[model samples]
Structure formats: structure tokens, C-alpha cells
Target chain A: MPSDVSAPVSNGKPGRLRRLIAARAEGEALRKGNLLVLAVLLLVAVVALLPFYWMLSSSLRMPDQMFANPVQWIPNPINWASYPEAWGAQNFGRYFFNSSVVAVLITLGNLLFCSLAAYSLTKFRFRGRHLSFMLILSTMMLPLEITMVPLFLIVNSFGWTNSYQGLVVPFLVEGFGVFLMRQYMLSIPTDVIEAARIDGASELRIFWMIVMPLCKPALVALAIFTFREAWDLYIWPLVIITDDALRTLPLGISLFMSGYGTAWDQVMAIAVLGTLPMALLFFFLQRAFIQGIAGTGLK
Target chain B: MSPVSSSRSARPGPASSGPKTPGRRPWLTPGSKQTAFAWAILLPALLILAIFRFLPMLEAFYLSFTDYDLISPPRWVGLQNFIDLTQDPLFLKSVQVSLIYVSCSVIPVIPLSLGLAILFNRALLARNFLRSAIFMPVVMPAVVMAVVWTFMYQQDGVMNTILGWVGIDPVPWLRSSSTALWSVIMIGIWRAVPYYMVIFLAGLQAIPRDYYDAAKIDGAGSWATFRYITLPLLKPTMLLVVVMNVIVAMKVFAVPMIMTGGGPGDATRVLPLFIYQTAFEFFDMGKASAMSVVMFAILMAFAFIQVRLFTRKEEQ
Candidate 1:
């Protein structure tokens, strides 16, 4: 992992030897400082992860043992039934299917449309191009609150209330996705497209056969982001859809608390369940999530 | 959300013309017939934005001036909702509470994230694990966090249980009107800091090691190097993090809603929840639209100023 792997003293003459000792002293001090930083960082990490740990620990405990006075980190007897019971009681299978469908649809929609828009913008010569782009950017400034009334009206007019189309279609075209794809495509060498053009490849053919193949990383990043956003969306879904069967994971988890009036065990169980898919996604492809964030250049 | 500034994506390709044509390929000019393909690609997003985003904005602005209940047709009563907002004590308090929430969440996040990121950057062991752990909360749904946090802050909850070990009396967290807002603020911080830290970590990585090495060669101490070199370069990132944090904090709703329902007595009510209550719970769409317009204005002002500042800095 070292950027330059040569030893402190590649040439060990007398003066070089003395300088090496001095450099070693500096290295020692730097390591010492880094150790202090590492200790503090580990402390913060523990604090940051404490809730997850507690949630996991509590989830495995007997229901009655959850709030036992002088709470023990390790309960006397572990209980695993809470997982299955909570899953059964909360209609989690249905919620999971709903979340999965929404997330997947949104991801697919974003990947397809965003790349097409990106391709056209990067590869075509069109009028008012900048204005169209500016219009897209301008939408980012409008708070969702301002759009709520009209959106609600339009959805109602379409009779899309309590329907998946209402939830998914409006979000299929994301400005951010278009923006990210454009930025990435800007970096793609124009020669490839010209070569494809010389071969008489159509625009759609070039996009699919050439650009899309090269945009895998950006597409993966966009997919992860769209999935997470769709999975966690709360307010709009809450406002538009009222049917008990139509709630997303977030709404479903919250409903568990409100309906049963906050049974600590049940809430914890559901929270853990709700967090599982995304958490596993993070665990396995943390690289993709980090890449997604960095690729967006927002960080 | 701001308008989709997708300039990079929608930039027109260079004109295609023979040398003889000499800038006369009018078809190839941007925003003309030739670029219809690009516009076609952008069409779906543009259509959705028009219908779902922009149309509602205009409608909301129109509604804010009237006295419309959802059941009854909106009646034109110009500025009544605004007047009602001005006179409404709860609305005033909500505005104040929202400001407090934004200020509290935004102010502390930068320094906290910087400190955390610097530590993580310097750490040699368990670096990846620690980073993932810190960033875990960022992806956790806010509703889940609220549910779990509400449990932890209960009178006999885990937090008070820990407090008991320190001989501190049990403190009502979300239940007490006075403490509820602050409690929500803590959750906001806890939930928010990790995201900012991830950003700061990326910024930290971008800082070239040669600068630190040069500072070291000059016999500069750790603090001097950090103050003189690190802080200055990180300023741009710090500004970005603060602006984004404030924007996210301003939209905070699910956290407070699930945790306290805006209170023991409206103590925790902020604008979004307030808007929800006004529009849905009370069925007063007009008054709700007024609050929405106010929120839209505040956010727009913030975004405009922020984008200007960001672009200005970039230009410099």
C-alpha cells in the first residue's frame, strides 16, 4: 500500500546514515501522533455503532427482559423467536416485496433514462441545450413542499392514489442522475463515439453498445443511490398513499410503532428488520456506496 | 430541491458542417432541430419535473393566498393565509423552532465531522471498519432511527438506565416540553454527523501528503501543520458540508414526527410537520400551502446564496 516503498536510506554513507536516524525519529513521532488519533477514532466508532449493537443485543433477548433494571449487555437466555414473530406479525414479507419492487424499478428507470439523457447531451448538437439543462438544475431549488399541492392534485386527477405508478413513475426521471451521468460521460473519450459513428452505428446503438458498457461504475452508483432513496422515501409516499397495504418499509416500520403503541421489543425487532437489506447492501458493497458519494462530487 | 442544473449533461455537441458551409449549419446549432435527439432523451425527466415539481410550485403559491379546505373549493381570499400565519403563535414558534433546529444541527456538524474525519484519516488500524461503522447511520432510515431513539430516551429507557449508574436523576427526554426539542436536536446531530464525516474523509484524502511532509521538514509541529495547512485547504469542503447539512436539517420531519409527534405541547413542532398537521390533520390546504410557500422561499434564499458563494469561490 506504500506509495514509495524504498527504505529510509537507499544509500547508507555516513551523512546518509545520520539523516536516516533523524528521519526515523520523525517517523516515530508521527506514528505516535497517529496512534493517539487512532485511539480517539476508535472511541468515536464505538460510540457511533453502540445503537446498532444495542439493537442487535436487545433483539435477541426475551421480550420481558428488554428493560430489565440495570440492563445487561448479555441477557441470561437468548431468545430468537422475536425475529420470526415480528416478521410474521408486521406483514414484513409484503413490505419487503413492496420495498424491493419500488427500489428496483426506480434504479432501473434512473439507469436507463439518465444515461439516454446523458448520451444525447454529450453526443448531440442541439439548440437551447444549455437552457434545457438550466431548467433541470432549477428544479433542484424548488422545495418539495411547494410542489406537494400540485403533485397531489395531479396524482388524484390520474386516480393514482394508493397505486405503485403514483409512487414510482413521478420519480423515474431524476435530475441528479442525469447530472451525474453527464459529468461521467464528459470524461469519456469522444474518439470512441466517433469510431462507432464511422461504423454507421445509430445513436441508440452507440449508447447501448459503447457508452453503456463503459458506464458500469456510474450506473452501479446510481442504482445504489436510487434504491436507497426509494427505499427510505417517507413524506411524499405518506401524503399520497393512505392504504394500509401500500406503505413502504419506512412507513411500515413507523406504523408498527403507532399501531401497537411502541412495544420496545416489537419496535426494535421491526427496526432491525427494516434496516437489514440496506445494511447488508452496505456491508457487501460499501465500496459502491462510497464510490457513489464520491462520484457525485457532493462530498 | 432546486431546479435540475444539468448543464453538463445537456451541453450541445459542436456543429457539424463542411468547411464550405462556414458556420451555416443551422440545423447543428444548439436548441434547434438537430438537437431534438438530446431533448428527446431529457423529455421524460423534463415532463415529470413540469408536472410533479414545477406545476405544484405554482399551485402552492396560488393556494397560499386563498382560504381552501380540501373538501371545499379554494376561495380567493388574498393574503388571508399569510395574515393567519403572522397572527398564529404556533406558526411563529414553529419558525423559531425550525431555525433552532437548523442552527443547532448545522453549526456543530462541521467541527465534529472534521475532528472525526481527521482521526479516521490518521488512524492506521481498523480504518475501514471504523469508517463503515460511522457511516452506518447515514443509510439507516430516519423513521427507524426515530423509533429506536424514542425507546432509548424513554424514562426507563437505556439512556436513563446509563444515567442511573452515574447517580443522575431520570430525565424525561421526548416527553417533557422543555427538553423535547433539544432531545430531537441530539438525534439530528447523531444522525447527521456521520454523513458529513464521510464527506470530510473524502476531502481529507484529497489533501496531498507532500504538503504535510513539507510542513514536517520545516520542523512544524502537528498543531501548526493542521492549522496552517489542513484547515485552509479544507475550507471549501467545510463550507459545502455546512450548507448541505443545513438544507437537510431544515427538512427534518420523520425524526421528530415519530419521536415526539411535535410534542408534549408543540415544543418540537417544525415547519414540515407543522405543514403536515395543518394540511392533512386539519384539512386546511390553504394555510398549509402558505407555510409551504414560506418554507420554499427560505430554502430558495439559502440555496441561491449558497450556490452563489460556492460558484464565486470556484471562480476565485
Candidate 2:
């Protein structure tokens, strides 16, 4: 009736009205389809985050209630005692310090050394330049897992075991970092470097002042990547650090878990503490982090 | 490849800019100076790599052939370690375990990650927040992931509790030999799916929007559009994800090491974890190095494919 009231009596009126109904149906279907997609994505996101939520909830629950029937999704009288107990139980303060020192040094070293190598590889023409680049790229196959035996022998020979140098030195400059920096620097215009060169600016001056400033995004990406890898280092430190005082966070947590397997609250607490720094870093630098990964893959 | 190589060759000659009197300052040629500066900048990194990466690689190869136990000097026994490995049941079992882990984990990762990527690629509300939430697993430290997962996989843990709500009997996740490796495999998929999803999302975004519009005009359905348009354009990204997923899966260590410690039997003893135990716990460096050489070969095959893929892309 409404259609009859609104419709004009013309030859094309029925056909136009039919098209209008079809388009409306299609639009409604599309809207429903979008809602379905959103729901699916939200479910996946929840599934992905469930472990983290469990970690937090377990950390806050009392020891007796950890295995309660129906599963305490939320702790009623929240136990905040686990944090200090876990931290003090294994001298975690020292472990955090060790992790911080090692991660910072490794990050700085990669940013400086990888950028320098990348700059030379990209912007400069010299003999054996391609050879060097190829050789560096080939190192991708030689992950620490395959090389740890000889590396341990080499480190022990240097008497570097149980020292920061053992953990930090071997990982200072990664092949992946060099590759990432090279890929990013390839997009930097050659004229800019040449113009600075023509002005009689020293190479170091040009690198420090002109080139490095233009590479902020790549640098940030490299820094975060190196820092995360260094912070999460487990195998190398497990092999090298026998001294409890020198153990990094991963080593300390593993040892703590083994020693106090029954203390679920404390174990979860250490897990949360160990994960906090990286979570915070990612939270703040989410855009750069995602873009960095996407850039590497797309490139 | 041709463009990059040609650009390298076309760099301006330093001879074009020199003092009028060439013989007076032969050592000060701009070309030589540039070379020197480049080498100076590259020296520190090259030195570090030479010491840490190159030397150890060579040492690993050499040590595989020689019997060494930190106390005694290495004694060369040609092919003996390799021969022993052939007869070693644990080593063989570990290889099987690693193969199973790699195939099972890597296979699911490809489709699941791509599916997630495709879903996220759609325009929707709170997309960014949802993406960030899914990405949280990636930023969790591997050690913490191992610890938290070990907690969750316990008999009375949350994982079993949730299954009960769905009217399913609780399963022994990491306890029995039958399910231990599978449990570790599940964790591997959980962590890796999010990472490779990001990579796949990048690949999806790289696809030109015009293709979809054209497909729609041709009356193509959703499945057909994905099959013809999306699949063909996503070939390179698919290769990258497969290679990277296999590599990560092969190198999985921290989880099994912390969770099962190679298990109640040899259920979850992946190659790397077995190699560690052989070298450190068992003090058989020669055999361990031989195992490393084997891993190196497997990884190199994948790495070779990756390099070819990259070079081919460059040529295009």
C-alpha cells in the first residue's frame, strides 16, 4: 500500500521498484555478513587472549583456590602477596637488572653496527661489497641452536662464561638486523648522501647527522626487535651462566619453576613479572611494531 | 636484480673529480677514500660476525668430526659420530619427534593464519583493538609462555575446566606420551598463528583494490573471487609464510624443555632439545655437533629456498 501511494504511474515504475527492493535486500545481507565477520574476529581475539587472562587470574588467586571447582575466573580476596614472595624468593631483582643491562647493550650495539654495515652495503660501492653482503645473508642458517656447542667452547676459552659479555657480545649484531636495515636504507635517496659528501662533510658526520636522523623508523624497529630477542634469551644464558648471580630473567624463572613447582601462585606471579616489560613496550609502540613486521614481510 | 646491479655499476666515477695534477696526490683519490671509509664503518660488525657466527659455524662443522670433551683435546674420528647417530635410537626418535612437530604445527599455521588475516582484512568495528588483542601472544616472552602454558595444561587447570563446560571429558594435555607432543604442538600454533597472521595481513593489503571491483562486476561469487583473484596474487606471501613457519617450528626448544623436559618417555624431545641434552647433560660434544650439522643441513635447505624466493622477487 505504501509502495502504491509513493509510486508514480509510469512505464518504468515496477522495474525501478523491483531494483530498489533487491538493493535493499543486498544491503541488509551485507550488514548481516559484516556482523558475522566482526563476531568471528572478536571470538578469535578472545581465544588468543585467554592464556594471558589465565596467567593474571592465577597470579592473583590464593594457593588453595587455584584448582577450585568451576574455576575461579576472578579471585575474590585478591592475593597481592605473590608478587613480593616470588621476587624475593629467587633474588629476581638481580635477574631483572641482568636482563635490562644485557638487552640494552645488545639493542644499542645492533642499532649502531647494523646501521653502519647497512649504510655501506647500500650507499657505497667497494670491492667485495656484494660478497660481504652475501656472506652476511648466509648467516641466517646458522642460528644459535646449531652453533651453541662451538660457541660455548669459544666463550669458555675466553673465560667469558658467567659474564655479561658472554650473553651480550655474541648477539650484539644479528644478520636479520643488517638485512632489515639494508632493506630500509635502500629507499633512502642517493643524492642526499652525495650532496653531503660534496659539501666536504666527513663520512662519520654525514652518517651521524644526515643519515641516521632519516632512519628513525627502521632504527626503532631494530631496537625493539633486538631488545625483545635479548630479553627473551633462554638457551644461551642457560648454557653460559652457572652463577646464580649472573642468571638472566628466563634462567631465573626456569630455575624458580623447577625449585618451587608446587607454588602455582608464585610461579604465575614470576611469569607475569617476566612478561610485563615486553607487554608494556608493545603496548606503547604497537603501531611501529606492527608496521615493522609488515614491512619486513612485504619487502 | 638487474636494476639494483645496474645502479651499482652506474655510480659516479671518482676520477671525474680530482685535482688537476693527478700525480701529486695519488693516494687521495676519492674512490679509494670512499672504499676506505666504507670498510672502516663495516669493520666492527664484520669482526663481531667473524668471531661469533662464522667461526662457530666452521667450528661446529669441524667439531662434528672430532671427539672432544672440554677437558681433552679434540681427537679426530672420521665419520664415527655420524655413524653412531645412525645407530642411536634416541637421536632417531628425536628426529621423528621434530619432523612430527614441524609438519603438524606448520600445516595448520598456514591456513589458520591466512584465515585470520583475511578476516581482519575486512572492514569492521573495533578492528584495531581486536588485532592488538590477538597480537598479545606474540609479545609474551617465550619463557613466560612456557610457564603459563605448563600451569594451564595441568590436570585440574583452566584448560580442562573449560572443556568440561562444553560437555567433553578432560584430556591429559602434557602428561601421557600420546598427547605430550601434540600439546606442545598446540602451543606452537597458538604463538605462531598470530605472527604469521600479521605477515599474511600485509600480503592481503598489498593486493590492489581494483581486482576485487573488477571481479564483482564480472558476477563472481565470494569463494570464486578468493580462489582466482586472492589466491594467485598471494603466492609469494604464501611461500614466505610456509618457509618461515617451518623454520620456527623446527627450532622450537624453550617450550618442550620447560614443559615436558623431553617428556615421560621421548614423546616431545625435539631435535634442538635433544641436541642440548646430548651436549650439555650427556657431555658428548662430538655427537651433539653431528646433530647440529644435521639440523644445519635441514635449515639450509629451507634457507636456500627462501633466498631463491627473495632473489626471484627482486628480478621481477
Candidate 3:
């Protein structure tokens, strides 16, 4: 087929004319295919974003006019009061504070500790090295349901229930973070570490100075992922946090829905606020966010 | 709960070339110093994992067999909790419900996502814009998704209104037990498709373009190219998507918990929700642990298959 097309049908003018027409037809088909792909993707994107768009639009939907019959696609008279009303309706301010503090602390802990552990694993050779690596790897697959009981008991033993320690400590350094940092750290050459060591830099110093900086991209990815995971904490917090004041954003939103009963506008407003931090993180670290999943070759 | 980070199996590598100066620093570090260094750096992570992670993971197995109610010392009752679960209709029903939910949501996702990926793989106009728009839900916390969907699925809400446009009746999305599980499952698919699409898109992008060029020159149609070149190459990625999605789907708790609280009846009460209620609401820790162990066994079987698949591929 290729020979026939490229040989230019060297015999005649009719053949050359046919080839030009065929090429033009192919271009038209290519254009047609492009349009089809574009149309399908666009349609799917609209459907995918519809709920988010609804959350935003409905949040802005006028509180009194929220019940208008035909489904207000756009809030005809835009309302910003729901944002303030929703914020005041519950302990959302407190929820926001708790979520931020916990997410930040967890992210910082993961960035520091996971890197240390990964660096140790990648740069050093020791007895039972493979065992420890596999052990950490195994924990990554253990769902919270499997371990929640004993973990709850352990947290309760320390009198940490309803406290920040219970929410913050168990998730401080996750297995995903450890594995991510380790994979990236493996590509960091050992020569840099050896030189730093020969110069009498402490192991901690080398990790802090040489290893940490080299692992910057991975650290950013880990930080974004850790913060996202921490922000998404619901079941664990719901189980442990009995006090309403200690509720995170997820709990607060659920509580607000139940407490306010039918305040649809306010409920949507809180949903928007609940999702804001993650949206902001996506805006800034979209590359790291996508790369963390794609580069790691898992979803 | 499935770890998606760098799920590639750890494999041995070729020996590294020796240092240019062989006498310099003993090629990385000496043996004894390396062990001390490893211990020093590894202690904090190891200690934390040992206390909170490893212990709890192992204890999950033991806790399943004992009768504990959070009030007193757990008494040994080997296989009693598991046996009771077999007798409990709700637990048995939940297992059935979960299997149906996983199959319904996960099976449809592969083709839907792969289709999306194939479209986005082309250099169509506004490709990134379209890709990001679809992917936005994956970033939204599951809590927000549940709430938003709960609102949308109201009797007189946007969903029903849309259905009315097409002359369809307002189905009780969350009000009826029959549609309640499917309502949550729809949301599950909504959130899941984009995530798996991203995975599939990455897989598509990694394939060499030369394969397509060769197929095109051979007069192979688009479907033939996809069937031969794309599908075969996407096997590993497809396995990851299927296994991870199954594991994640089996653990679907937040959506069902928030949306229906297990249902108008026992319709949406999945395994995790059942476990939560048994442990916390009913204060039957032993029963909940037993259920989790059962869920764990199911997930482990999927995981084992994944390992076998990958190892087989590597051998090939």
C-alpha cells in the first residue's frame, strides 16, 4: 500500500490526478475526525463540569428565589449573601481553621519524614532493607476500615480522641509519600552524598542539605497530595470528633446540611467553600498534581 | 485506599560502574557507617509505622476473631464474629450490594474512560481546556461531591427537571430503595471516570506513534489499530485501572453514608457503612472488625491477581 502511494504511479497523468484527489479527500477526512473527537470531548467536559457549575450557580442563586420552578440555570438576580450566611450558619470558620491547621501540619510532617525515610532507604544499604521497604509498601494498600478499630483504641489509650493529635498524628507520614520520595530519590546520584559525607557532613546534614533540595519536585508533588488527602479526611474525623466545634470542613458541611435542613442556597455555598482549597491547590500545582498520578503510573 | 503511587514492582538493576577514583570514599559509603546512617534516618518513620501502622494492620486480623464491645476487655471467640456475619441478613445483603455496586460502576468505566482518552490524545482544538474541565471532579473532595449530588437528585431538583425535558418521569433518585443505590453509583461513576481517563490518557500518550504510522500504511482502519496496537499495549494500564477501581469501589463509604445512610431500607448499606454502624453505632467492635477482615480478604484477592498479572508480564 505504501509503495503504491509513494511510487507516485509513475506511469500516467490520470494516476497523478487520482493521487492529488485522494490526498485532498484524506485531508477532509482528517478534518472530519478531528471535529468528531473535539465534539465528543467537549460534550463530556460539559457533563463532567455540570455539577461543579451547579454548585457555584446554585450557591449564587437567590435565597428566596431558590425554589423557582423551571430550574434557574443562572441566578437571575445574583446573591452573595449566601456565602456570608453559610459561613455564619454553622461553625464553618472553626471548621476551616481546623482543616487548614491539620492539613498543613500533615503536609509538613510528610515532606520532612517521608523524605528522610526515603533517603535512608535509597542511599543506605542495611540488613532487612528489603523487608522494611516492603512493610511500608504494604501499609499503603491497607484501607482504614481494616485498621480503624485498633487505631481508634490506640488513639484512645493516649487520650487523644477529639484532640488534634488523633487527627494529625496517624496520617502524618503516609506510605504513598514514602514510596514517591524513594522512587525520585533513587535517581539522585550517590556521588553527591559520598562527597558530602567525606567532607564530614553529618548524615542528617546531608539529607537536609543535599538530598532534600534534590527531591524538590517530588516533595512538591508529595506536599500537594498530602494536603489534598488531609483535607479530604472525613470518616476518621467523624468517628473520633464528637464535639461540634472540632469538626473539619467535611464534617461541618455534613452537619450544616442536617442542621439547616432545607437551606439549599446555604448548603451549596458551604459546598463551594468546602472545595475551595483543593481548587486553589489545583490551580497552582496542577502539573505536580497530575504528574504525581501519571508519572507514578497509577491512579 | 489502594496506593496508586509508583505501583511498579521493585526490580533489581544492573550493577553501577565503580567510582572513577576507586580509592575515593569506598564507592558510596562503607558498610558499618551505612547501617548506622540508615538506623538514624529511619527511626522516626519506622517508630511511627510500628506503633500506629504495622501493629494495627496485624491486629485487624486478630480483632476480627475476638468479641469486643469497646466497654471491656476483648474476649477470644475464634470465628464467632465471622459466623455471626453469615447469619446476619444485613451483612450478607451488604456483601451482595457491594458486589453489584462494584461491577456496575467499574465495568462501564473502562470503555468510557478509554474513549475519552483516545479523543483527548488527538491534537483537537482546546485539548488541555477540555481535559482539565473533565478532571476537575477528581480534585473535588468526595464530601463535596456527595453533597452536590444529593442536592441535584432532589425530587424537584435539576436532575428531575432535566429528565422532564426528555419526557421522563421524576424517578425518586434517593427516595426509593431501588434507585437509591444507583443514584450514588452514578455519582461514583461521575467521579471515577475522569480519574481513570487520566490514567488511560497517560497510557495512550506513552505508546510510540510509529506503530500507528505503520498500521496506517498497511491500510488498517482506526478500529483495527486500536484493537491490535492500542488494546494490547494498554493491558498493563487497564489492569491497574481495573484492580485499583475495584478495591476503591469496594470501599465506597462516604458517598453512600452521606447520600442515603444505607438507604430508604437496607438498599445502600455497603460493607464499610455496615462496619461503621456495627462498630460505632451498635458498639460491636468484634463484628465490625470481622466485616473489615472480610472486605480485606476480597481486596487482597484482587491485589494478588494484580501481582500475578504483573509478574507474568515481566517474565514474558
Candidate 4:
């Protein structure tokens, strides 16, 4: 018989049989425990996704059946009219265009400007380098909520109110993006940069050709982060945009809800449409998204 | 420039690229060129921030001390807006409501998110699928969440129907002053818990696996392993989550703005919402700036601690 360190050994057939049974029981218990954990986690995940399911299902339900008694978990004869009606009711096309422009510009601007600044902060030794980095870091404390008033006055002074620049310029470069990029850049080997310098590569050429490509993971993460934040911009647009034509998707959806409050089906439809772009973005870049969020906390 | 040249000279290599020009100033070395290049690249970001963030921040402080409405020029009224805010009932109510929101939403999130993180950290069937499922809420935009939750919170709506399954009465969620803040609080927790859970999972994964294995060899139970091996190492992440979550909760604007509009007698009137109304709706820019300064101070207090913790970790 094979010797077991933890289990008592006895020189007999009965002892070997008993050991086999005990090991089998332990294995059975472990499998059952795993099943229990899986079951519990599945339940939590269901609850987490329940709202999304409700949003989609409610969007497909007929107007009258939305508040049906006992709650129809699934819509019967799924109504597709809400989408078209909702889209027709508002200038949703304009709103989607506005959101896309603002978010894309903001994302691209962050990727470019933040990477340039991060490269400077990480790769170069200069006077006030630390001070400049700290200055940028301190801005994280001054979110749009606190600075929006003066920011509004400043935008108004520039004659930017009711303009796209009003929405996009203030948020073109974020403190968090710089900080995220800086943290990621710190991990890069200075030896490689030094070697590039020895090869007589210009500073800008090194940043553009060598450094930027190596930082793809962080850049991808920052891109998605900035895009989502820009797309989700509500308060800034609400404050600056008085022109209905320039309103973003969130602003448009809010107006739609208040103006047509009782049209729950249509409201859900707008909600779904508004959420779809972000959901798709997240789905495609799930790994980068998770890594980006995890990076912030870990760092 | 002298400091830049000296710092560069302190380094052993990379000073060999450019020729040493005769009779040149000490500061006009290769290092100076590098410094100039760095500043050139950094100029755009610094300029943008100067215009948008730093300038406005300074302006907010200045405007808080003046009486400014959009039409007339800002009239210097030292301490008037601050004094008025101290005695304003609605402002006080907003402060109270915001405190309630921040505290209620932040406190429970720590454990709930940490617990969820621990669960998701375990090896299980389709674990990635489950984590992704739970993470779906974070993808939903805040505006959509507010609108959908408003639909679900109606008296005869899905929330009430779910409560019925548990033998509870249909509660008026957003209509009543008493329950309105709590309703907002529920949504805050729902959205936050998943986001922070991901953070906590990251923290969990960071802990060296050898510690847990050592604990198991010592016959330690799961609870003991978690208490000793998990919690201590996760201190930094816990601090990060707390500070981030509190800042986020304090800035809870879109959800309440869209759902209740700080309604049912200012029950859900968070600070940002009140600041918005005070500035734009009432055109009381000075008073709103004062409120914003107060909010900034509160957020800075939390941020100060975070900076301290992170800097200390870096030093170690």
C-alpha cells in the first residue's frame, strides 16, 4: 500500500479500503463545495444583469403591457415600434453625432497630449519636471463639479457657449489620463531610451516611433476610459448647451424623458440606444477595459 | 537650466551625443537641449490645463468672494457669499443630504465589494463569464441607469413586484421624502459595488499566492487565511477604493438630477445638484462658487490622505 503522510497507516486490506473511501469522500466534498460557490456566484450575476434584461425587455414590450400585473419577465409579441417612434420623436441622430464627435476628439486628444506629456515626465530629467507632474496630479482633486462655475464663465468669455469647443476643449486633457500614462511609462526600461538616444534618434522621433508602440496596452486602456467618460458627459453639456441641435445623447434622452414621461416604452428605447454604443465598446475592448480599471487601483 | 545641467552631469552616460562647443555657457549643454525638447512636448497639455483647470480653479476662489451674476460684472463682496451660505437653509439641507448620500453609499460598499471580489477571486466554473456578467452594470451609462431605475421604481413597477415576491408592500420610492434618498442610495450602491469589486479583485490577485499556500499548510481555515493574508495586503487597495468611492458618491449629480431633481422637498439634493441650481438656475454664481469651494475642500481632505498614502508607498 502507498504510504500517506497525513493519514494513519495500517498493514491490512481493510485499512487500504478505508483510506480509499476517505479520499473519495474528500474529493466529493470539494466538488460539492465548488458547485455551491458556482451556484451562489451565478445568483449574484443574475441579479447584476437583471436590470439590463429589464431595460431590453421593457424596450420591446407594447406600451400598454409595460406595467402588466405580476411583471412579464419576457415581453409577448415583442414590439419594435418604440425604437422607430422614439428615434423620430427626438433629434437623436444629431445627438448621436454630437456625442461621437465630442467623445472621439476627447479620446484622441488625451491619447496624443497625455502620451507626449507622460513621455516627457518619465524619460527626461529637467528642472520643474516633478513640479509639473505634481501640478497635473493636483488637478484630479478639482473635478468638473467644483470648477464648472468658473469654467462656464471662462467658456462664456471665450464666446464658446453653445459651441462644440465649449464641450470638448475644457476636457481635452484630463489629469487622470496623464497620471495613468505616467504610471505605465514608469515601468518602461530607461536603457532602451538611452540606447535610442545613442543612435542619434531625436527625442520626438523616439517618443513617436519606439515609446508609443510599446505603450499600446496602457494607451488602449486610456482610450477606452476617456471615450466612455466623454460619451457619458451629461452635466457639462447640460450647463453649456442651450442649443438643442448641439445637445449630446444624454441631454437628448433627458429631454425626451421629461417631455414624453408617460411613454415608458419609448423612454426605454432611447435608454437602450444610448447604452448600446458603450456596451459594444466595452464588449470589444473587454480586456483593455478591465486592465485599465484594475491598473488604477493597483498602482 | 543650471539645475538641469548639473543633474545631467551627475549621470554617468548619455552626455556623449553632442559636441562640446567652445566658449558656450555651462547651461547650454546637451541636457539643456533635452530640457527644451521636454518642455516643447509638454507645452500643449500645460497650456490647456492652465486655461481650463488652474485658471478656473483660481477664478472659483476669487468669484466666491464676490457677487457675480452673468449680466453685471463681478462686484467684490468679501466673505458675503460664504457668510450667506452658512445661514442658508437650503444649502444646509443640501449639505445634510449629500453627507447622508456619501456616507450611506460609501460605507456598505467596502464590505459588499470586497466580499464580491473574494467570491469572484475563487476558482469556479465559468468564472470569467460570471465576472463579465456582473461587470455589465459598469458599462451602462449613468443617464440610462437613472432613467431605467426611475421606470423600475414606480409604485407598481418591477422593484415593487420583486418586493412582493418577498411579501413586502409596494413602497413609493422616489415620491416620498423619507425613502427618496434611500432609493438614490440603492442605485449608488448598485452601480458602485460592481466597479469597486473589480478593484478589489485586482487587489486580491496581487497578493502573493505563497501566503495563502503557507496558510493552508498550517491548517488555517479560509476565514483565517482571508483575515490575515488578504486584509493586510489589501490595505492600499482598500484605501484607494474608499477614497475613490467617496469622491464619486459626493459627485453624484446625473442620477439624482435626472430622477428626482432633488425633489420631495430637497431630500436628494446633493451638493453638486444644488451647486448647479445655484449657479445656472438662479444665476447666483458667487454663492455657487462658494458652495463649490466648500465641496472642493471636502474632496481635498480625502485626496490629501490618498496622496500621502501613495507617496509613502512609493518611498518604501
Off by over 4 Å in 3: A1-26, B1-27, B217-220, B308-316
Model with the higher lDDT, candidate 1 or 3:
3
Query: DockQ: which candidate is best?
Result: 1
lDDT of each: 0.75, 0.83, 0.79, 0.84
Candidate 2, residues A1-299: lDDT per residue as tens digits?
Answer: 00110111111444445534544667878678778988888898888999999999899999999999978899978999999999889989999999999999999999999999988877776677777887887776678899999999999999999999999999988888898788667656666777787899998998999889888877877887788778989999999999999999999999999999889999999999999998898889887776655655644
For this target, which candidate reaches the highest lDDT against the unseen true structure?
4
lDDT by residue for model 1 over A21-132, one digit each (tens)? 5546768776777677777877877777878878878778887877887697895698877777777777678777887888889889989988887667655655665666
The TM-score each candidate achieves on chain A is 0.88, 0.90, 0.87, 0.89
Q: Scoring model 2 with DockQ, what do you get?
A: 0.32
User: Candidate 4: which docking quality band?
Assistant: acceptable
Q: What share of the true interface contacts does each candidate keep?
A: 0.50, 0.63, 0.52, 0.62
User: What 10-residue stretch in candidate 3 chain A is worst by lDDT?
Assistant: A1-10
For model 1, the stretches where C-alpha displacement exceeds 4 angstroms are A1-25, B1-34, B215-224, B304-316
As a whole number from 0 to 100, the lDDT of residue A212 in candidate 4 is: 93
TM-score of chain B of each: 0.84, 0.86, 0.87, 0.87
Backbone clash pairs for candidate 2 read none
Error of 4 at B214 (Å): 2.0
Q: Which digits, one per residue and each the tens of the lDDT, describe model 3 over residues A109-202?
A: 9998899888777666666666777788777678776678788888999999999999999987787788778767766667788788789998
> Taking the tens digit of each residue's C-alpha lDDT, what string does model 1 give over B75-189?
9999888998999999999999998998888888878988887776642566677778878887787888888888889887888987898999999989899889999999889
Range of the 10 consecutive residues with the lowest summed lDDT in candidate 4 chain A: A1-10
Candidate 3, residue B23: Cα displacement in angstroms equals: 17
